[model samples]
Structures are given as structure tokens and as C-alpha cells.
Target: MKISIFGLGYVGCVSLACLAENGHNVTGVDVVPHKIDLINKGKATIIEKDIDEILLANWEKGNISATSNYKEAVLNTEISIICVGTPSDVNGHLNLNAIYQTAEQIGAALKEKDGFHIAIIRSTVLPGTNEKIGNIIAEHSGKKRNEGFAVVSNPEFLREGSAVKDYYNPPVTVIGTDSDFASQKISEMYEGINAPIKKTNIEIAELIKYVNNSFHALKVSFANEVGNICKKMNIDSHELMDLFCMDTQLNLSPYYLKPGFAFGGSCLPKDLKAFKTMAHDFYLESPVLNSILDSNESQKNQALNLILNKKSKKVGILGLSFKKGTDDLRYSPVVELAESLLGKGFSVSIYDRNVNISKISGTNKAYIDKHIPHLSELISDDLKKVIEDSETIIISHNVPEFKDVNLRFSNKHFIDLVKVKDIVPSANYEGICW
Candidate 1:
């Protein structure tokens, strides 16, 4: 396969060398004469592990070359990968001038091209960028999208220090495009790489890098804060973190990664508060740790707003416990939500088979009595009665009895906090965080 890469910076340089090593004739384009000259002279533009050898070997093999002529590069290649930089502006927003300029140049070059071309955006960009690029190319080339050409969002996952290794051993190869031909071509280009090829919506492909990097930043901050507290306490932070990482069941795993309602159970809230208090007592500021509670409260507020936005006076809560298959009501978010709804003058009805208010005792009983004094009036074991009486139903947890309530009660609007099923039944269904 023949390919042209725009922007001979870190990502472009590594991509050019790696793609050529993968048996593709690659041409690198850059505005800077120095970068172009360096690549043409069998020298790498960026210094990193194995890049010099790979670039020199590929350049000597006549598999790779560099040029400043965008028209020549686009016309000679079957696909063009945009590796342009999307740096931050003064306001911290993405400066996309390079990406847009590259798109315009590719579109102009496509004007005289005879066959279909695929433009792959390997740059880190936000959502909706692919559509804008497609439109720009279509307007400039006077050709319809997916007919004369296609734009695919194939974001690179290369880290700078280990760029060459990361390129060859990417976690996943993502191809976001509407064209099957373009997807197949991109997938085939990465045929030698050992990674799962994931096909997804274009926006997801575009936004994933931001999500990944933000989480990475969060992880680093969290670790540093923990390290600060540990160091002050004369404890080995490394040993603590090593032990923490060994717990694959919860820590370093996807246990609580799902987007859903705010956490309100016995252990999470209590432990988090304790940890934050420990940090506070040590005269240490743990912003990331402290922000968790605020974020959780915001999520609770979000659920409340969703329910109130329905404008229905009668709201039925399908599950009252913190989670499904539990009788525990202490620190339950549903309990708090129900209390809020009742306080707001909404006719609230709850049905949780696990929770029997009269039979409830201990902290759980005390919790309900203090929160909702008139629990006997609002709570019921009859799911059918709750569904039949309310205009809007809130499915707080995924209980077996509430699985197909949407299908059964077509007239009632359902606000699913916990996704009741894989597929929703009605047009009136709303997920709290889909």
C-alpha cells in the first residue's frame, strides 16, 4: 500500500518509519524544509528508541521519502494520514488550524485525482472533526463524501518516549468511518500489528484520546497525593501503591468504571470520607480525593433534575436499596432521591422487595425512619401497583422483577438509573447516564 503522512513531527515521523517498516511505500510531508531534508537524507526528524535505525533502513530501501509538495504526495498515495499537531490555544481550547489546513490541502490535491481516496485523521482531535474534514474536502474537491473519497478518524495512541514501540504494539486499532472500503483499507494497513481492530462511531474514536489522557492525568495526580500523605506518615508509598495495584478485582480493574448513578453504599462513602479526613488532618490538600464527594453529589442532583424535568407529580421508584439484591437502605441514594421527591411535593411511591420497612431494624431502619418518617405510606411491595399508579417510573436498580416493566407499562415514562436491560423498550425511556 502507498501512503502519505502530513506533518513530519513526532507522530508523523514515527508513523512514517513504522508504516514503511510494515511494508508500505510512505511519503512524509512537512512545511519545514529542515524536517523534509532530514527525512530525505535518511535521518529521523525526532530522536527516540529504534527510530533512527528504522528511518535510515526504510529510506535506504527506497520505501520511504519526504517532500514538501502536498499535491505530489496526495496524488501518488492511495491514503493520506493527517498527523498534524492540535496544540492548545490561549484559552486552552484546541487550535485546529493545522488539521483544517491539511484537510484543505488534501481536498485541493484530490481535485485532479481519478480514483477513490481515504483520508485518515491520526491526529488527536475532538468529536465532529471528521465530519468537518469530510465537508471541507467535499466542498474543495467538488466531490461527494463516501463516493469520491472518505475521511476516517483513526487516532494514534503513541506516547512520545516509547513512540516506535507503541506504534507497533498499540492497545487497539480503531477505525471510525462510514465507508466499509476505507475501514478495510485502514485495517489492512495495520495487518502486521498485533492488536484488536475496533470499528466504532466516528465521534467515539475522536473523543477517546481525550478521555484516555484525562484519566491518565487523574491517575498521576491521585498517586502523587497518596504519595504525599504516605511520605508524611513515614510510610513507604511505593510499597503501598504496589499492594494497591495487586488488587485486580477492584483497584486496577474495571469494577466501578461504568457511568451510572452516584455511589451511596456503606463502604465507599465511609472509606472515602475517612481517607479524605486523614489527608486533611495531615495538613495535605488532596483535591482529586476531595472532589469525589462533590462529583457524587452533582450526579445525585442530576438524577433529581431528570426526574423533576419529566413534570410528572407521581414518580415511582422501582428499587429503593443502594443496589439490587440488598436490603440495605443506609446511605442509599434512592432513599435520598425519594426523600427529595417527597419533600418537593411529588407523590412518590417506592417498591423494593428486599426492603420491608416494618421488618427493617438496625442502622437501615434508623436511616429510613429519620429520612422518610412516613415510609409506610410511600413504600409498597406490590410492583404492579407502583407501575400502575405512577405516570413516571424511576428504575434505580436492575432487579429481576423490574426487567420488562417498560414493555409492560407502555404509557409510563421510565428513567433508568441502572440500565434495566440491554435494549430499552419505549421511546419514552431515558437513561440517567447512557
Candidate 2:
């Protein structure tokens, strides 16, 4: 396959060398004449382990070259990979000037060239960027995407130091775009790589990089916090962590790893309170530990604020339990927030996919029912009826029906306390955060 990669930065240089080494005719494109000269001279523009050998070998073998001509590269390739850098703006938002400019250049090249070429974005961008880029290209080229050409988002998960190995062995290969031709073309690029290929929408593809990075940052912060606390207490943090990691049952499994209702249980809530109390008693300023409760409380307040802003008497609450697939309401923040709304005189209707008012026989069930009188009366078994009769709907869980909420309750207003969708703010929509 003849492939043209735009931008000779870290991502582009490594990708060009690696793909060319695998027998693809790869051309590295960049505005920088020095980078192009470096690549054309059988040398890598950037430094990476084994990249010099790969770039030099590929260029010497006539499998790779670099040029500053976008038209020449596009005319000579079947696929164009956009690996431009999306640096952050002063306001912390992504600056897509490079990407948009590259898209325009590629579009112009596509217009001049008369072949169906697949455009793949390997840059880290925000959601909806792929579609925006696709639209820009199509409008500029005067050709329909998925018909005359294809556009896709295949985000790179390459680390800086070990990018070659990471590229060949990524955790997963996420391809965005519904076109089968686009998927096939992109998947063929990674045919030799040992990784699961995940097909999703453009937005999810864009967000996967950020989500992975943020989780890694969170893990680092959590480990540092644990180490700091252990240092103050004269305990071996590494030993404690080694022991903690050995408990693979709950520690390593998919527990407490979802974005949904506030975390509440006998153990988590009680232990958090105890930790905060211990910090206060020891006069240790443990803001990280204290912030767990503060963030949870703020989320609950956000849910309450969503309910209050409705200005309607009848508000439907979906998923009464703190989480779905469970009836344990002990320390459930949603239960407390619901009561606060009731105290303010809002008629609330509740529906839970897993919660059964009549079948709940445990002490937990009895306690929750007693605390919130008329629980069974306000609960509805039908989800559609709940949305139909209510003025405002507050989605607190990722229930099965909640996926269809956009189409189901398209007429009614929604205050989504959870980030259910990529962009939920429509005419009658209000996501917690977009």
C-alpha cells in the first residue's frame, strides 16, 4: 500500500519508518524542508530507539521518502495519514489550526488527484473533530465521503520513549467511522500488530486517548498520596502496595471503575469518613483524602441542582439505587438528594432497573423504604411511562433504557447528572458536563 503521512513530528516520523519497514510504500510529508531533507537522505528526522535503522533501511530500499509537496504525496498514495500535532491553546483548549490546515491541503490534493483515498487521523483531538475534518475535506474536494473517498479516526497510542514497541503492540487499536471500506483500509495498516481492534464512533475514538492519560495521571496521584500518608505514619508504602496488588479479587477487577452514581456503601462511605476524621485528628492537611468526600458531596449537590432548576412540580428520577444492578441503598447519595428535592416540594417519580419495591426482603430494603416513606407508591415499573408523564428526567445511571433516552424523550427536557453521551446538550438536553 502506498501511504502518505503528514507532519514529520514524533508520531509521523515513527509511523513512516515503522510502516515502511513493514513493506508499505510510506512517504513522510512536512512543511519543514530540513525534516524532509533528513528523511530523504535515509535518516530519521526524530530520534527513537531503532528508528534510525528502520528509516535508513526503508529509505535505502526505496520503500520510504519525504517530500514537502502535498500534491505529490497524495497523488502517489492510496491512503493519507494525518499525524499533525494538536497543541493546547493558552486557554487549555486544543488548537486545531494545524489539523484544519493539513485537512485543507489534503483536500486540495484530493481534488487534484482523481483516486479514492482514505484519510486517517492519527492525532489526539477532541470529540467531533474527525467529522469536522471530514466535512471540511469533502466540501473542499467536492466529493462525498464514503463514496468518492473515506475519512477515519485512528488515534495513536504511542509513547514518546518506546514508541516503536508501543505502536507494534498497543493495548488496543480503536478505529472510528462507520464505513466498512475505511475500517478495512485502516485495519490493514495494523494487520501484523498484536492488539485488539475496537470499532467505535469518532467522538469515542478521540476521547479514548484523553481518558487513558487521565486514568494514568489519577493512578500516579493515588500512589503518591498513599506513599505520602505511609511516610507520615512510618510505614513501608511499597510493601503495603505489593500486598494490596496481590488481592486480585476486587482490587484488580472492574470494581469502582465506572462513571455513574455517587459511590456509596457501608464500607466505602464509612471508611472515607474515618479517613477524613483521622486526618483532622492528626492535624495532617490531607486534602487528597478529604477531597474524596468533598467531590462526592459536590456531585450530589450537582444532581440536586439539576432537579431544582427544572421548575416543574413533577420530576422523574431514573435509577433510585446509588447504582444499577443492586438494591443496596445504604449511604446512597442519590437517596439523600432525592429527599432534599422532596423537602423543597417537588413531586418525584422513581424507576430502577434492578430495584423491586415489593420483592426487596433484606434489612437494607426495609431501612431504605422506612427512611423514604411512600417509596413503593412513587416507584414505577415502566420506564417509558415515567418519561412520558414527567416534566424533567434526571438520568443518574447507565441503565439499558437510558441509552435510548435521547430518542425516547426527545420532546421532554433532561438534566443528565452523568456524562452519559459525548454531547448530550441538545434543544431540551442538559448534560452534567459535555
> Best lDDT goes to which candidate?
1
Off by over 4 Å in 2: 276-288, 305-329, 348-434
Best of the candidates, TM-score: 1
lDDT, each prediction: 0.93, 0.83
lDDT of 2 by residue, 1-434 (tens): 99999999999999999998888999989989999999989988787998999888889899998898898999899999999889999999999999999899888888887878899999998888988888888988998888778888889999999999998899999999868988987888888888999999888998899998997787777778777777778999999999989988888767766554567766788997886687577676767777888788887787777767767878888877766678777677777877787888888888887777777777777668666877888788898888888888888776556766766578888877665644445788777654
lDDT of 2 at 70: 91
Off by over 4 Å in 1: none
Where does the lowest 10-residue lDDT sum fall in candidate 1?
419-428
lDDT of 1 by residue, 1-434 (tens): 99999999999999999999999999999999999999999999998999999999999999999999999999999999999899999999999999999999999999999899999999999999999999999998998999999999998999989999999999999899999999999999998898999999899999999999999999999999999999989999999999999999999899888888989989889999999999999999999999999999999999999988999999999898899889899899999999999899999988988887768998888888899988889889889999888999999887667777888888899998987756456787888987
